[model samples]
Target: MNTLSSYKHDYGPLPSEVSSAIKPIYEELSKEELLERCAGGFTQNNTESLNQLIWKITSKILPAGSKIVEIAAFVAAGTFNEGVLDLLLFMHGMDLMLARNSHEYA
Candidate 1:
């Protein structure tokens, strides 16, 4: 059997240290403070989804300017929260009218 001490000797630090070393951490999670923090059951689903949407709009393969990235984030967030038709609302708010074909597309 691999005991904690033996595992530490063979592999390096304990689980806590290993977890802390990685990005987007998975905690050792036994500590009271850590457990309490996680009691609410938070996860990165929304943030990750927003990032995926933004990347789809802006293209990670191509360099994008700050304004372009900002616009992409806005569009992604608006679409994610309210669907594609939200763009029509935004345009209407700005007094910009869309053609019949554009309305159909929306």
Candidate 2:
């Protein structure tokens, strides 16, 4: 297993592709807007919002089951960083949990 340091050396930051994908939703927003939406404390609503956005984008381009992994690979290749992989995994897990909760509520 790659250590976090190795991962960091492997992947420096988010990739252009991932940034492009996420940009449509976030890029237009001002810095303050982003802070408003994502700041303060973690909440179910915020988590759901982030999950929904990622799911919407990932579903469009990735096959299923491996969307996050594929995205991580892309990020790793594009940025030579692995922390991005961890971030994607965490986001994916949040998306899954949000989806499950939405289903349960429905």
Candidate 3:
């Protein structure tokens, strides 16, 4: 049986008021727009790694403004999408030079 059917079987039918409260939410979730939004499904692996990378770029212990956070996110995204070498090259193109020793790590 479906999950909703199983739930009803185990716990009896939802009260009219409870069902009414849930109906709109269920309807909205089942709609094409929401379904399309959910089509990609959920995965936290990449996001967690990217967040770690961002925090590494801009330390979590320090207070940062939105612009700093934004820059860190962009840098993290570039590093994640490309590699350190490419990110360094891109920064070079934009006239942002890394220290001579830092290039060795890349």
Candidate 4:
């Protein structure tokens, strides 16, 4: 999970222009907004970790032939289970291209 970053007040000051533009917006964010950003960051990290693990297992299982289809299957499963379309279309397209290339090469 992500945590809010804290800075010391005694740190050197930013340039005047950067301070003017950033300080107000930084101060205006509520505690809830900060927590929400942290939660989103944690979710993204977990998803990436899970993707890597799945990919490692898939690669081992199919050292030959097309791993693209296997990756697409995992992505589509994620979309069906979690309803996030994250990269599913791209994976599917790669699988199609791989199929086409294998057929052409043969």
Measured by TM-score, the strongest candidate is 1
For residues 1-106, what per-residue lDDT tens digits would candidate 3 score against the true structure? 5685465444638888998999899988788986777679753578899999998999678899999999889889989988787677767878986898768878
Residue 76, model 3, lDDT: 90
Model 1: runs farther than 4 Å from truth? 10-25, 28-44, 91-97
1 versus 2: better lDDT goes to: 1
Judging by TM-score, tell me the better candidate of 2 and 4.
4
lDDT tens digits by residue: candidate 2, 1-106: 6684355445637877886798677656646766687676653574465455455545556566785756644544433334334444555666754455543433
Candidate 1 CA-lDDT value: 0.79
Note the Cα lDDT for every prediction shown. Answer: 0.79, 0.55, 0.82, 0.60
Q: Against the hidden reference, what TM-scores do the models get?
A: 0.57, 0.21, 0.48, 0.26
Model 4 lDDT on a 0 to 1 scale: 0.60
Worst 10-residue stretch by lDDT in candidate 3? 3-12
- Model 1, 10-99: lDDT tens digits are 464557665567724543556578778777977557889899999899977878999999988988889899998888877887899788
Clash counts per candidate, in order, are: 0, 6, 0, 0
Q: Which scores greater on lDDT, model 1 or model 3?
A: 3
Clashing pairs in 2: 10-80, 10-81, 11-80, 11-81, 11-82, 12-81
lDDT tens readout by residue for model 4, 1-45: 344456355675787799889877877765677778877556456
Task: List the lowest-lDDT window of 10 residues for candidate 1.
Answer: 22-31
Q: Sort the predicted structures by lDDT, highest score first.
A: 3, 1, 4, 2
- lDDT for 71 in candidate 2 is 68
